[model samples]
Target: MALIDDTRAILGDLIAFPTVSRDSNLELIAYAADRLGAAGARVHIQTDETGHKANLVASLGPETGGGVVLSGHSDVVPVEDQDWSSDPFELREEKGQLFGRGTCDMKGFIAATMAMAPHLGDLDLSRPVHICLTHDEEVGCLGARRLVEEIAGWDEKPSLAIIGEPTEMRIVEGHKGCCEYTTVFTGLEGHGSRPELGVNAVEYAVRYVTRLMELREMLKGRAPAQSRFEPPWSTLQVGRLAGGVAHNVIPGHASVDWELRPVSDADHRFVCEAIAAYARDDLLPAMREISADADIVTHVIGEVSGLEPVDDNEARRIVSALTGANGADVVAFGTEAGLFQKLGMSVVVCGPGSIAQAHKPDEFIEISQLSACLDMLQGLAGKLSTAR
Candidate 1:
């Protein structure tokens, strides 16, 4: 079909930009804004603080309420160490798959949505169709959070939000919320022979990490019996730990990076409070006894709220109707869906490609998957056009 060809062409252009999360994505965002704008959509660009990156929100058809939003992140994970047979930034088609860095992790959905832009102007629609493209999603969904805040201030709120994360075209009803933290432990250094005169930061860091492991177990036990989630429990892990320069010298500084993926807000709060209580009541006393300067500090680095499946979710119903899928799923990885849900918009995570291919080397999306996505968007367009 012509639309499928357009989608592939757009996907190629998008893949060429290499919008890695660590680098600026202004080039890609500008390209998308221009394309969508040229298609007779009203485009609004939300630039980041440095103006090096942006989020694009474009609407077609009516400017009123109760429209559908198609959302996708523009950034891809880094390809620095991955073993790729072809240039990760260059799109290569082999057999029935289109290979590139962002093809599966997402720009495929973005491209498909953009390909449908021209048709939006022609559709005799009652409610508008909105495109929400954000940056920095690979890095803890920072862009989506900002976009959600911007959306919150809009005059006309959308009725539903479909985050085009790779779900193999399945309707994703829920996923876990991820919160990351870095805890720094500081102590007074002294010679190894005079250990009592110095506070050992490494030792205390180990103790704190041990406490985190205990919390992990506590979270595991908090899983609800009726939960549909795989593993069916909230999880915690200390991903990175670094401390101590040399064995002879008493180490004075240590840092540990940890994360919690909570199934519920209560579990999230419980985990945070448990860590704080342990730091305050147990760790601080021992450290202060040696030197007043010794201390522990924890900072939240990244966080994305979890998507809870609602029995009567509007977004889920809309997606199921469009895709003709009666059942929904829960994913282990995080996406921007939760943020939209928090903004009072019903949300579903459904898109082409398998997440198993996401963030891996030689990432590719099957051409058939892209075709399926285009068909789904066309179905949505038909629905919006007749909704009056």
Candidate 2:
């Protein structure tokens, strides 16, 4: 009950930071670092080049290899254009749930982890418990990429990572990768009467989209036998397209925003390479004929790797035993788990709250969820204290 009260207090302070992906999360990082430092943990802050955002990695217990990492992101999506019953940044308790922007999406897990830090520090542990809180995960797992790179260079690296991504405290072993992109097309604008004199940028952009759809279907055929993912294949969608001024005039520029959720590496490679070839060999050459200055360019917004499942998973076994879970599952959403997996760590996603409440108006997490997360962390502490 004391841990629950401390968790609630910490969650309120975390919600007040307003660390949106587009804005700085330095304040939140500082607060977490201070709290963990007070509890006798060795804390390090990894900041981005801009110094506006940072990742927090703290080590408790013995400074040794084969530690367990508790990870979560510090950033939340924007609150603009959404209707809320109360201020999105203010933590509001209603019934048995705590309402706020990051409460469920997930500062809740971070709070629970932080609340038990003192207890973890007091234990006679044989292994370390690492706290990894990151920034800009909503944008593309940007912060975790840097964090894992830092972890890789260390002499004492963790062997397991538990990504707290609001999975109702269930153990999730796999999820799809998210790749976002934007492509721009440029051409010569001329009178609409004679179409041959000018290249139509919109038409060529449409062709690029068509190529994506074709590849989307191709990905379907390449799906592995009895895949667990819903639809059982990688998928693509064009999010936005904007171009042209009027019906009679030829538009000189156009752009399309698109994304892909890849289930595997082969599918990701196939879609990316095919799209590049289509643009280079088919679209650009033809567009340049009408105007030598014509061009097509693609910008990478983000490329988050997918968490693959494996039977030889220490993190999964440990979490399953602690939670007394009989089964594991895969989710459709992306998380920072895959980036940690790239470092050869046994990664598992087990945390409090529900994904359904994330990034919406009046988002909330049940108090029971935080209490459950506290129990898991406590169990983890006991296990680490005994793993000697």
Candidate 3:
């Protein structure tokens, strides 16, 4: 079959699984593993704690050293409440665009790579080529973190990793880190009639949230003079908050779900430490004055480190040579690239489609983009076929 047809067939199979982040992605993993295994590649599967999800690492050619890793996530975001013209799990094409959940955000790249698998064995390669599909990346890069730890223990590691996130086929060198957290406040409740008798948890929660906003501004002021990020600063925001039962009573419990996107690890550490200090020395002390039992607790739910630009990056150079681009770009979104970079591999983000189309109603990827990606991968295969 032609590359386009093969890619579409594989992409359709991937979309049919409905591997949402909330659900198990073993089905998708199994399909990928089967295809890679049939292609004469050595496939390794790593199961997560629940054993319901897994990551697959498949390699073609010799496994000694100096290989390129094409990595993408198997799981996608939820399609709930999104109004689509057709079934989100069914790949539909109209006017040269393929519509489906995960089509743009990911699976397209995976499909293209799988389409190349049948031809890999025919190449006269000096180095190996690896295809790595991970789970739960939409949640917090969970599977990639585990996979990276496993890779760290390997005797042989890839020279470069290219994360197939939606980058419109451009080379992306950097992205900010994301940290998600929740703060819960517990206080004494009483009737609204006695204003001074009760410690209102909702009120304290608001105060804490207000402090977070102030810190957000402070972070804005701390942006590095030469920062390349679009906003040129860290960002903090509260996404969800709830607590009160009745207007006539003082609520005893409240919670806030918030997140931080930092350009640097120092910024991340600063904001986290500042928040903890505020809760301990400023907010919690005031809350406890009303009632000794009053307490504020913060828990970090997720963290994906930012990808910082590095000097002499082989992944960037290879992508630039393939795409014929002069420079790389930066994105506001996070990816598993940083985790791979932490494992001492040169990492770059380059893939088909636009991120603007990702995680939205009627998400889609242009057929032209997929064709371009196939061409790029073919170029990579040609490069790998010759001895370096």
Candidate 4:
């Protein structure tokens, strides 16, 4: 069968799994593992503490140096309120597009890798090819974090990790880190008539937000020279702030939902340290003086590392050659490529579709895009072939 046909067929089967970020992806993992294992590739499944979700790592050819990883998230965003023309879990083909929930965001790349499974043994490869399918990427890149820990333990490390994010098959060199947090304030409630008698949680939350804005402005000055990202700065936003039950009552509780998209690790650290010092030295002392029980807590939703663009990136170079791209670009969105890059592997984000279609109603990847991705993979095989 042609690679395109096989990719289409596998993509349909993959879409049928309906592996949303909030749902278990073990079934999908099992299917991929079985397929890779039958193709004489070594397959490993790393399940999180909850066995319901898993990451599949499969490799072909020798397990040693200079191997390349084909990576993609196996989970999709939800279709809860989306108005789709057809069932999101069922793949629908129309006018050269394959419509499904995960089609454009990621599953298309996974299918492209799977389509190459039957021919794994046909080539005498000098360097190996590895496929990594991770769960919970849409949520927080939780699965990739765990999967990288497993990769760290391997004696032989892959030299490159090509993250199959929706990059329109163009090579992407960098993206910002995503860090989300929820800060809660606990204070004593009292009559509004005597504001000094009690600590106002709402007031403190506003102060915290003000501090965030100060840091946000400071980030602009610290932006790396020649940064590729638009606005070219580590960005911050306070998504929500809530407190005060009524005007007459001093609120006992307040919470702030906020996020930081840091362009570099140093920027992330600087923001975190400044916020902690503000809370510890200034805010906490005053609040505690008023009420011994006054306390503030910060909860981390997720802190994904950023992929910084580098001059000596093998993955970018290889992908550029394969795709005939003249230069690499950066994106605002995050991907698990950073996690793999942390392992000292050159990482690049390149895959078949536009992210504009991801997480939207009737998400899709064009058949032409899939065909182009297959051609690139075939080119990669040729590059890695010992026969060359």
Report the number of the highest-TM-score candidate.
4
Candidate 3, residues 137-224: lDDT per residue as tens digits? Answer: 9899999989999988888888899998989999999999999999999988999999588888898889889988999999989998
Q: What local distance difference test score does each model get? A: 0.91, 0.93, 0.91, 0.92
lDDT accuracy of residue 96 in candidate 3: 97
At residue 158, give the lDDT of candidate 1.
90
Residues 17-113, model 2: lDDT tens digits: 9999999999999999999999999999998999899999888988899989999999999999999999999999999999999998899999999
TM-score of each: 0.96, 0.96, 0.93, 0.98
Candidate 4 regions with alpha-carbon error over 4 angstroms = none
lDDT of candidate 4 at residue 140, scale 0 to 100? 88
Tens digit of per-residue lDDT, candidate 1, span 1-388: 5999999999999999989998999999899989999999999999999888899998998889888899999999999988999999999999999999999889999999999999987887888889999989878889989998988888988978899999999999999999999999999888999999999999999999999899888888899778988889999998999988888899999999999999998999998888899999999999999999999999888899999988879888877888899899898999988898988788999999999999899999999999999999998888887643
Residue 310 local lDDT, model 4: 94
Clashing pairs in 1: none
* Per-residue lDDT over 1-388 for candidate 4, one digit per residue giving the tens place of the 0 to 100 score: 8999999999999999989888899899999999899888888889899889999988999879778999999999999999999999999999999999999889999999999966865788898888999999988899999999988988888889899999899988999999999999999999999999999999999999999999999999999998889879999999999888998999989999999999999999999999999999999999999999999999999989999999999988888899899999999889998899999999999999999998999999999999999999998988888887
Q: Which candidate tops lDDT?
A: 2
Error of 2 at 95 (Å): 2.3
Q: List the lowest-lDDT window of 10 residues for candidate 4.
A: 117-126
Clashing pairs in 4: none
Return the lDDT, model 3, position 218.
Answer: 95
Q: Which regions of candidate 2 fall more than 4 Å away from where they truly are?
A: 386-388
lDDT of 3: 0.91
State candidate 2's TM-score: 0.96
RMSD of 1: 1.6
